[model samples]
Target: MTNFLPMTKDDMSKRGWDQLDFLFVSGDAYVDHPSFGPAIICRLLEKSGYKVGIIAQPDWRSTNDFKRLGKPKLGILVSAGNLDSMLNKYTAAKKYRSTDNYSPGGQAGLRPERATIVYCNRIREIWKHTPLIIGGIEGSLRRFAHYDYWSDSVRRSILVDSRADLLIYGMGEKQIKEVAAQLSAGISIENIRDIAGTCYRTETLEHLWDYIEIPSYQDVVNSKKDFANAFKFQYLEQDPIRGKTLAQGHGEQFVVQNQPAMPLTTPEMDEIYDLPYQRTYHPSYTAAGGIPAIQEVKFSIVSHRGCYGSCSFCALYAHQGRIIQARSTESILREAQEIVKMPDFKGYIHDVGGPTANFRQPACEHQMDRGTCRGKQCLFPNACKSLDTSHTEYLQLLREIRKIPGVKKVFVRSGLRYDYLMAANDMEFLRELCEHHVSGQLKVAPEHISPKVTKLMGKAGKETYLKFKKAYEKVNKDLGKEQYLVPYFMSSHPGSGLKEAIEMAEFLRDTGYNPEQVQDFIPTPGSLSTCMYYTGINPLTEEKVYVAKTPHDKRLQRALLQYRNPKNYELVREALVKAGRQDLIGYEAKCLIRPPRNKQNIAVSQPENWNKKRRLAPSRTQHSKTKQTRKI
Candidate 1:
């Protein structure tokens, strides 16, 4: 049931076929989200018959929308807007910073790297020799050679700076429909090195280059800061012809392929969530006034894909494989009744959840024929004596999508694995997920409260986030209201520093809660927390610790988790007086600590140098001399 190749728009003006066997090209904007992983590899290469077309956010104002799909037998897939903008260009250089500090209600800004290297050199100047295939989550978490955090160094290998001919890393729907059915059967880009979550670039040594297996771009150019420990260090099981080999050798003697990374069939996730969504917004972001598409149109729905809470600053259990794979709850209520027949259905659907949305299933049941369960601790971290924690079909699929009918509210807004909801056997499903899917704040991440930095970020401790914040404040004080939990904390992870971010800013000043948004550990790219943020230790427990590893002490331990900013009170008062913690300095530190008063409101809002206040006003010397003479 996988043979697709049907081009439309009157079959490309009845066969003068201006290049399309597949094209896509995105950075996100084709009514983004819930059509993820590059809109399911462009609807699985238009259902396997390839002749696709898409250019979502392209138009570098002439390069004719990357040459209006006109030079394509096969070339171009690209995707940079999910999985944290495909492998970190430090969230696309903090969205090309001219200051908007990571999505302050985003405005489709930040495109730099010279506008993504001039939109990949104008789509290779209108497809010269086609093929560009870069793959999502910021080109598969910056495929090979890491650390760029807005060019702070060690770059190269986003497939040789996006010149891209191949790079289809992680969860690419059957490696982009088997590289668009071997480039629409004509093959040859040196025969796509037998495609399997591809990453090409070679000149020889072919153990199947024409059939595809030429990986070893000089062991990712001599182990570029150990490309995610050389792709999870070796795990081959199938590569006689491409698909599943998950890493091999080069640098620090690599080897993690004990076989297990592949899971995307539920009719390839319901034919990539039945494509063609016009959830809308992106006529160059509604003509640059941006930041509105009904506030980034996210009626999203996924439910599950993979993650069994490995969390060493996660890469979703190494790119989707801690095994979960959900979808059918009548395919998430027919994609939440087609996002309430979208004309921007804003009765709030926004997010249902995935990756950790109360983990829908597959922690084991020989995970659909013996694929994952080689278990290594994760049954609510110490409760897995054959764990079940009964989510009861994810709380009966969020109570049948809050009984459908123009659903007005149903957000789990992702990130909720609170030790699998404090190993739920029913706190009445967290009081029916806080009386019908909270929107009046519920977030939860508990990223660190310092049980030795949540066991070096794999997590579970600080009494399991103070027992899920006293069972979400005793189910919001017996549903008497005033619901709140937002939590989420992380600062310089890699065995945290400044005494575990001042013991997590004194456990958020003794749990009154301070987080006015904090997250500073950005080591991204196939995480194990960016190999303990570039080898401060713990590449699988080689331990060692104390690493705020600079970036001005990881921005003063992420401004001590928003100690109510006065530009983070003189860098958390010189990191709490160089960690002797001068009793958390100045304001009796009970927590939401905002004192240095934005450096006394930037020295009382500047602008007062009218000739240095008329040369320190009063020419004092003359006045003093006159007074002295009078006294004499």
Candidate 2:
């Protein structure tokens, strides 16, 4: 029978089972949609001839909630929800956010900080021998010893803190399959250390082969130089084709990560997403307004996974990897047909894309056999000659979805890499994109326009965005459509300073763009930019980079993005004067902000004070595959 995995003891009883083979514990409320990681993992296990039940957002104050399903026959899988717990609970400014989109009714405080550790510790107090496995964004990104921005220190790998028997780094289906099979065959969790994309801790590294050793946890904590070096080593070796096993010492023990699992093939992607997902939050959550995060993705089709954009601030490179694995056109159409039958679907199909919507294949021919050219990016500084910039497959997929019966408008909400589209040999994708796919405004991420800052961000040059903008305008002009392009901008990245901030403000002024969506960089762990933010050195170049560390600098940079706003007038005026661009403070049409009308001082609200006003956790403002925290 197609149903939600057991969430309560009575659910198991109804399923005619006294115990489950695996107990899945997630920090988010259980929403059995394929988009949610916990649901995917549990559903995948169920399809593989194993029994799995989810214990979503359990109360960690006591072990009772953890014990509701009793000890699993084989193991327990832990995840910190779709988004990381800390990032889910707080805003970029490090203030308590009142809403958690993953929680039921958008409630807060259901999960504790560092949820994996707390949950695992609670599980251990009762069932010490049951195998514990941790994965998902929080555990995967923190699989190594890395910097923690909230604590202002380098913490050990999550494996050490959670005491999990194993850590699966990437999207963990392949690793989980192997572990489950081994466990089912009477293999112990202690001996299941050699699987690809899995991490295990040991007192010795003698059993490992073809491995590289990174800086020990102590070295990273003590020396910023070592910290940069350690991050650089791990950054370049993320490819499955060329990546090697990595070992890092933490005190007398070591955390060893095997080579990443191979990217899922088209058939594999089809099956995983096709699993019988209930496609909504549990029925038990109906009264509290259900999960807010599922609203966007419930009717949306995830056409693909992974990205190669290599934006410095994004963790997709670390989590989903660069390889593009997409579902077959038939599979996507099948899902679309299913959505058409849903009770609440309406006629509009919310989205039909994933990561980079336009990306339908690997960046180049060599990626499948030789891996991504080690440190070089396919779309950075300039588009690589070997890069394949075709949108033919994706455009056809969209056309087919539009043809589906009872479907009206289909929008491409996933980010479209404009630089890639601009570099393509065909203009049909851009033309068709503007005419058919756009829903009035197409959102693109042009994080920064400053050459130096863009260079550090691993983004295309300003010329690319400019050229694409003209093309988009021309396309909409020919189609007689008045569509708009909403460009997402970020402030206070590692390489951005007052000079760069003033330049962005000037670009906004000249372009007449008053950004409602602004991303102030939050240095989350497991990203190259976070490494630079901590050590003041770009891991890629090993050269010194300017980091805006102080609250004063962050305020000025963020305020500059919205210079025309009345609330940001003081900060913007002060920034212009600090940059020696006092000419921009006058009443001229080109000036970013006008001189104060009256000398009377006005109190402006800071981020901490402003977050006090309750708000839902906003959608993706940062340049990440995962929807991470942004300014409230």
The best candidate by lDDT is 2
Candidate 1's displacement at residue 443, Å, is 1.2
- For model 2, residues 1-632, the per-residue Cα lDDT tens digits are 23888988889998899999999999999998888898888888999999999999999999999999988999999999888888878777889999988888999999999999999999999889899999999999999998888888899999999999999999998899999999999999999987888999999999987889999999999999999999998999998999989999999999999889999999999999899988999988899999898878888999989899998998888889999988999999999999999999888888888888888888988899998889889987788999999889988998999999999988888888998888895698888888888877778888999998999999987788888888888889999987776788899999999999999988876776677658889888899999999999998788999999888899999999987568888898888888899988654555676466554665333345333332322322222343322321
TM-scores for all candidates: the values are 0.31, 0.94
**TM match of model 2 to true structure:** 0.94
Q: Whole-model lDDT for model 2 versus the true structure?
A: 0.87
Candidate 1, which ten residues in sequence have the lowest lDDT sum?
623-632
Per-residue accuracy of model 1 over 211-311 as CA lDDT, tens digit each: 32223435444543344344434211221122344433223222112123267666656656666544444333445544332343357687778777777
Off by over 4 Å in 1: 1-46, 50-167, 170-178, 188-190, 193-198, 201-272, 276-335, 339-408, 415-441, 444-481, 489-492, 495-498, 512-525, 537-632
Runs with alpha carbons beyond 4 Å of true place in candidate 2: 597-632
Q: For residue 353, give model 1's deviation from the true position in Å.
A: 7.8
- 204 in model 1: Cα distance from truth in Å? 4.6
